[model samples]
Target: MTQQHGETAEVRRDDGELIGMLRQVTDGGWVPCAVFGLPLATPRSAEAARGFLLDHGLGYLADRWEAREGGEWVTVQIVEARPGEVTVSYADYGHPKLFNERRTLQEPSPDDLRRA
Candidate 1:
């Protein structure tokens, strides 16, 4: 499959359609983001997004794996990370409920990295 790009982009779930944005945070790790709903949030409704990244603020960004996803992408959030695995969620903020589903990936070796 063609690799999808966009750090500060939307998270599309199912339907092969756009769901909402997935703003990636670059700091202590590679996957910390604030998910927001479609058309982007108007400062007010963006609480969820901002709140998620609130704690990670400066420190996390400094040590994270440098990366960027630039536009409205898919609805998936990396909630937890381990030495060789990661826990994720369907980040369709459009759903009323921000986190709709959760999943885990064993490992993302170099081969798993998406082509830029």
Candidate 2:
């Protein structure tokens, strides 16, 4: 999946082969965070980051592969493997219907305030 940021695009690869392109936002001198399809609002910690990604229905922890200095690979087992869809929520404050249907903010009359 391609992650669109603004203009520049960074090619992403899976298994050492080009799969898709992700847009770049800022230069970090290494791998751009946008390449992972994560927004800037993502938490900085690894655990929080993983949780946010999972909550947003991106990818899940299928298995973890760790490599040692000797080039040995270790695989960790995954309990769940159900992938879900990603959704983003937003509010349109400038819509004409929304503004028209909203309740008006009016100060109560002196008599009404006295009754309260």
Candidate 3:
């Protein structure tokens, strides 16, 4: 994808992982957030997404991931992250209930990298 001035792109790893490559607007620099994997199915709701992260023992505080919708992937900002728990808000899934609900993935598990 072409790099846009105000926008960034991320690749969703096969195992329903959230990976981010953030570009700073002021400095035009790129930084990579370590990849995080969700143990549960693709979260259909916000709450489920949060729970999956927490259960997986991935870093919770200030951790973020991307979510897919309508063939487009968008960023899901983690408002709360802690051991055994995570909470996120999506740019699109705005309904509090639907937004707060967890989702399931349509396909099977994909390959993923394990951190050392």
Candidate 4:
């Protein structure tokens, strides 16, 4: 896929949390990208991009996630989430002491994982 590039503007929460960013696409329209730079939607006007990200927020991360590990996908619990970093712990399925921590630069969105 061709990479999209443009001037960037950061959107932040009231508490100064970096929420997302608005990136200008080739057509001079803005695209709303998630905290870790995942494009969330089609190109829109600058104002629209900001509104989209604010409305989307971080609520989606509350759901369970599967992280790609060792050529396989494993269930993981999000220990912490920040703008560009996410800390996850492997889910312990009956094993009480096998907690492993992994840091991922990008946390996949629900659609990205396609959970059934």
Number of the predicted model whose lDDT against the real structure is largest = 4
lDDT of 4 by residue, 1-116 (tens): 11223487788888777777777888989988766655667899988888888887875456566765555566676677665556667774643444575556465554433221
lDDT of 3 by residue, 1-116 (tens): 11233533332344645432222333543433223223323223333333343354335324445555455455466554322244455534553444644443332122221111
TM-score of each: 0.28, 0.20, 0.25, 0.60
- Scored against the true structure, residue 76 in model 1 reaches a CA lDDT of 59
RMSD of each: 16.8, 21.8, 15.7, 6.0
By summed lDDT, the worst window of 10 consecutive residues in model 3 runs over 107-116
lDDT of 3: 0.37
Which scores greater on TM-score, model 2 or model 3? 3
Instruction: Kindly list the per-residue Cα lDDT of model 2 for residues 1-116, writing each as its tens digit.
Output: 23334543333343333222232334421222222232324224433433333343322222231211123222222222211211211112333333223221122222211100
Error of 2 at 97 (Å): 25
Worst 10 residues of 4 by lDDT: 107-116
lDDT of each: 0.37, 0.27, 0.37, 0.66
Ranking by TM-score: 4, 1, 3, 2
**RMSD (Cα, Å) of candidate 2?**
21.8
State the lDDT of candidate 1 residue by residue for 1-116, as single tens digits: 01235545333334543333344444422232322121122232234544433433323312322111243333555566443454555555554443556655564432322212
List the pairs of residues colliding in candidate 4.
Answer: none
Q: Which candidate model has the greater lDDT, 1 or 2?
A: 1
Q: Which stretches of candidate 3 lie over 4 Å from their true place?
A: 1-61, 80-87, 91-116
Best by TM-score: 4
Model 4 lDDT on a 0 to 1 scale: 0.66
